[model samples]
Target: MAANYDYEEAPGSYDDVNRQDLGYDPNFVPDSVKSFVVHLYRHIREKNVYEIHQMYENSFQTLSDRLFKDTPWPSVDAVSHYVDNDQVFCLLYREM
Candidate 1:
């Protein structure tokens, strides 16, 4: 996780969903979640196995626990456009 993203690298606490507030808004997507999805998608697209593993094992759970612990994740229909396949992503997301 440290190699993938350091506290120094993110500019602000916005990307540290596990540790920062990021101004909680149940109706608004947090910046940290947006950034995590983009970075994870980019890593998956590049076929960077190591980074993907790190993000999957470290970042995904952290954000999920911190941000969506008491709520359901947004539907695949809501976020699948960010990825290539809705069906595949839904399975992968369910695992996450």
Candidate 2:
């Protein structure tokens, strides 16, 4: 199912890593995942709604494949809960 997340630019600096530096080691998240997330955030910061939606629609399947290649299927309830929370967060940011 397609997620219904509105694109909204958050207030303040868009550089989340720098602005909210949690002092974690540079290698915490793998480089590949970090790169993907950074790219996604850049589109959001630029308010490129079409591109963001395109990227999510095009890449999520591949991303999920890579992320869960060897893992058991996630529960439907868990997935629904996560997606709902994500939608809420997206709405909150859009309202900012």
**What is the C-alpha local distance difference test score of each model?**
0.60, 0.43
Question: What is candidate 1's lDDT per residue for 22-69, written digit by digit as tens?
Answer: 444443555666566667777777889998888887877766766566
Please give the RMSD to the true structure for each candidate, in Å.
Answer: 4.9, 12.9
| Model 2 Cα shift for residue 37 (angstroms) | 0.5
Native-vs-model 1 lDDT? 0.60
Which lDDT tens digits does candidate 2 get at residues 22-96?
Answer: 432332332333444445556776788886676566654444354424443233333333334355434532332
Instruction: Estimate TM-scores for all models.
Output: 0.61, 0.41
Q: Give the Å shift of residue 53 in candidate 1.
A: 0.7
- Model 2's TM-score against the true structure: 0.41
Q: State the local distance difference test value for candidate 2.
A: 0.43
In model 2, which regions exceed 4 Å deviation? Answer: 1-28, 70-96
Highest-TM-score candidate: 1
